[model samples]
Target: MSDIGRTSAVALVGVRGTLVEVEAHLTSQLPTFSIIGLPDTSLGEARERVRSAATVADCPLPSRRITVNLTPASVPKRGSGFDLAIAMAVLAAAGTAPGADRRTVYVGELGLDGRVRPVLGIIPVVLAARDAGVDRVVLPVGNLAEAQAVPGVTLTGVDSLRSAAIDAGADLPAGFVEPVLLPVPSDDTPPPLELADVVGNATGVRAVITAAAGGHHVLLLGPPGAGKTMLAERLPALLPDLDTDAALEVAAVRSVAGHGVRSWTHRPPWEAPHHSASAAALIGGGSAQLRPGAVSRATRGVLFLDEATEFPRVVLDALRQPLEAGRITVHRAGGSAEFPARCQLVLAANPCPCGNAGTVGGPACTCPPSAVRRYLGRLSGPLLDRIDIRVAVARVTTGTLRASDGTAPTTDAARRSIGDARERMRSRLRGTGWTTNADVTGAWLRSDGRAAPGASDLLDRALDLGTLTMRGWDRVMRLAWTIADLDGDDRPDRRHVERALALRMAL
Candidate 1:
């Protein structure tokens, strides 16, 4: 009888589940290794790479017929992350390696030249492994930093198949060395853009501060030279640092997208896609596999759309779903993939084609009222309804320029205020599962019944006069809460409500 044995391991096809098992068997037949599974080209080729890697590592190759079967073979495997796993299984079956059943997951792409290459989605993969009671994971050296981001998992980085084999006791290479900690990248702090740099637009600055505090979406309609882009860039300065969970979410998106996850500590991402961005680029759609688009990458951060009106209607409409659901689902021939997209939207657009629709100092407007209406008409009412703040930015005047002294607080001051406001809101809505005012539903807003007496009357009048939709009414109430929180008030008062309404109707 031929001596036969099997070793087990796992591989991640997508972000969905933990590794599928790869069973390696050696039998009495012509020397040949065959891989049986629904594997893509990259995965199927792992057989040849593993053989060469073992040879380079000076490990003995089985002279008998070798066959590898990936169990639950119905599911597809797409990457070379299975190379190390397959190699380990082969060694274990030959009685060359030890610790084959201690729940150790391996993930890495093997280069034909025996180098371990980085693979995508390492963060999520390691996290899944850690959660599934897997005590340790062996990943490509380049991916060690990302794998380290996940706590509770003992991560070992391998440089080549030979190094990995020596660690597993498969074959003792000439110079076997212990695993070294991957060098961590030095932290680079982004220079802060101060609110004091803005010449005027005190009201606009305050509105942005409120948006940061409550996670509200804002639209800025202004003529040329109104500093719309400048203001949008400064919004991140007012935002609080990303929390631990939010930081991981942002890092995961970047990791899978092949962008290295630097520091997830306090950085807030800011994505400013050009107006020419396609629908797929904005909302994430591709042929076979759906990759994350700009909106998805902007999760838990800011998505600034400058010249928002210039974008196609289709692209603009795609944002509505993610904006409401905090995530987007992209369906394709293979399957659907969902990406987190909870972001603070900041849209800046010129008032009209002439860029002088309502400016005080500008050339005479030749476009008719119909054209102006059509220009703004591109933005649907439903979309406008979702935006909580609509402020009109005016061109800076001579007086405003003179007042651009350092008298006002800097960006640090505004950031502190935003932090304080967020803490207050989080405490109040702690048990309610609401993170910010923008996340509170209309029912919750009304149920609270904490609105000021005169403010309720004003809100009722707006609803009665058709000035506010049901959604708009809720957003106004949310804004009132944010304003009150900023002013250190325990409850929203009439002045806060009035100010909120004024900011909403600024455009």
Candidate 2:
């Protein structure tokens, strides 16, 4: 047989960019192994691990000069995920390792003693391979569940390189067992805080419901313990379960970030980053290769910012682009990387330095009006205009707090109502390519002018009164359509427009 041999393919695990392919070649020469293609430190070390794993698996090491090339050499590859693929490719090219089928993509990290270890982002990588017409995939035994989540792809799990080599038509090693799929466990529990426990903040509750129904951005101004965080946490529960495409998108992001969903159920994701989080952490970035950040991880979900005013102005301001474009671009020395950041933003902040600034009960306000203005002024007008609903939360009274005699509606009840409203909105925007009111542009909103007659007149009046800017008018009109949709109306009416305007002015 000819000594010159090559085996090459790609592996991808993220939607932020294209798939990554790995290629390997072997030739008769000095016994040296080299890996190319912009591999990071971890990937560069795969040469040693692959050789030891092959030896332990009873596969003869190639006594030749081996060169492995990962295509698109400019893109930096991280993690040990390429270990198994690289090793298999080397062995196949050396005419030793088993199962050299080009239709199957192998992904896993191999230990020196021949054990296969799980790696992150297997789900998206396998899905990408399947979409690219690859018929089968072999992954670490531990990652089979995640890989199996994607249908129509033949998934095989291997515990050691020995079994893989044997399956590939090589000599079998002793004490090798076929890998089996592990059963994934399920944990179903209700959310911690129910809307009924929120006591009396009827206006706040209404705003929360409306925001949830239309996937609108919300801002909550209240004291430290005014239930703002509680309301924000429950918003995710109010959102309808994610559809298939959205679920896949969310799963892909989590996988790339080395996290996985506990269950395959398509519940909306919730992400609440602390006030001290950096701009890079909120958006996404790293040294060599960029990774998904909180916003990208929370795509098609909710991102709650607590203690909003405490965050650095620069960090908070970085959100403007994503808020407007539904995506974030991280510029680097080599090039720019983009990530999806389309999410419902809920910001909770204290009213003033003392946090007791407009509340009826509490210590006397010591903060000057200038301090209060400065605190609130940190929020830019453009950012505030992007937010659809703004409500001030107030403390609940003792009687209202104690009156929860199981008579009030549970979160499930609220969720059902919100779910119905969301379905209605989705039906209305089926072919419009819009998922929520906040996503609708000015042109689209104006196109349906005659559809909602009084909406235009009311918006014009608000603009004339200087109560709303041009951008604010469009956002408020969008909110009006959302309100109408929540009320099961075909189009926004004068009442819906008035309610939306009222919510906007409440800030």
Candidate 3:
């Protein structure tokens, strides 16, 4: 026997996958098995599973000193997906096969009864393999669908360890039982949300449309039952579908989060975490392995925070960096992982803690001035400054409710308008590496070449009066450009700038 064998595997770091080389060696010493190369708790336990599975599959390990080493010892390895690779390498060292195929990557969990079990994040693993130009991959049959999503590679799915060992040139028994895999439950299909469901909130609807068109952040201050949540939920409906690259990014994030990636969706995702969620849950971190949080999962979509004031100040403040940089990095004792955070933010809050301070003809304002100020102060000035649109949604009155006809704005109409505006933005920003006005740099927007002539008079006045910070003024300029795009104008004029200013100062 050669007493040496090698194969390939993958190690997951956040949503990224790094190729790993698995090597096995046998010697004439005490009979034992060991795995090295910074294997974590779950990965270290793969020894017992692989040994038992190999014995059950009629290809037992040699009764001599056995050692397996995952090359690139610096990278921390987690999860049990390396079981198949580890088993194949050891069996090949025992002369079961000439040698494990170095060009083939193996990923799957082995059961004591010899069944090959599926592992999470198979999509990212296959993607990494494809990127590395690997010729073939052997994984659990249960994950074949998601693994097939990545092209340019041959995939071989195995239902049992016996089947895999036999295919690897082992002289094993012919009778083999395939593991029974349960059918994946279908998603509960729900009717798509519509913009017309919201009644008597024209200003709120308009703000959502502008935000969708420009990919801008929004804040909604209103009393209860004013349709603030409705407006925020419907914003995604007005936006266009995600492109191929974005859709793949979304699927990769979901796979890393342990969500199903069988079928991908072009529509952007929507994440609405409760106010009581921990900071680690909203951001991305964990004690053992770093995981993607709500913000990362909401990438290329909307992150709506309902009852914004009820959340802890520190947790809410954690969003500032991601909002500016379009990505978030989480640090832990093990290592740091970066997650995508390029999503629109929508904050919905009551005018006061009492929820009736500004209701019309319905309740009295019992909250004192100091109490109201303290309640609203939960939203820090810096955070609010990042929000481009601040609209106050008034309570629906008898007149507004009675006049609510079906002629109100429809999602289809708003979508068409937003699509046209986005096309204009793409044309204008052809080589800027930016797709939306909100992503444009303030310096670039202020440059003479790209600046809209005679549109910054109001912004300059506001800056001189110290009413708007430099950041706020830049956001206003972006909003004005979006308005001009919606109107199909060559550039923003005084009217568009004025409308943008009003939206910023509405509350």
Most accurate candidate by TM-score: 3
Candidate 1 lDDT, tens digit per residue, 1-507? 243334334544334445667677888789998888777777788888988877777775688788888877887666777788888878877777765533678777766667777777777677668767888888888888776877887988888877777677754755543343334444433456888887788777877889999999999999888888888888887888887878877877766666655634457888899999998889887764467888988888899999898887778888988999998988877767778899999999988888888888667677789888878877778888889999999888887777765455578888888889999999999898788999988888777736866676788898999988888888899999999999999889889988999999998
- List candidate 1 segments past 4 Å from native: 1-17, 30-32, 175-190, 261-263, 403-407
Local lDDT at 367 for model 1: 74
Query: In terms of TM-score, how similar is model 3 to the real structure?
Result: 0.95
What is the lDDT, from 0 to 100, of the residue 95 in candidate 3?
79
**Candidate lDDT (C-alpha), each:** 0.79, 0.77, 0.86
Better of 2 and 3 by lDDT: 3
Could you tell me which 10 consecutive residues in candidate 2 have the lowest summed lDDT?
A: 1-10
lDDT string, candidate 2, 224-280, tens digits = 788898888878878887888778777777666665435244877778888889999
| Cα misplacement distance, residue 461 of candidate 3 (Å) | 2.0
Every candidate's CA RMSD = 3.1, 3.2, 2.1
Candidate 2 has a TM-score of: 0.91
Model 3's alpha-carbon lDDT is: 0.86
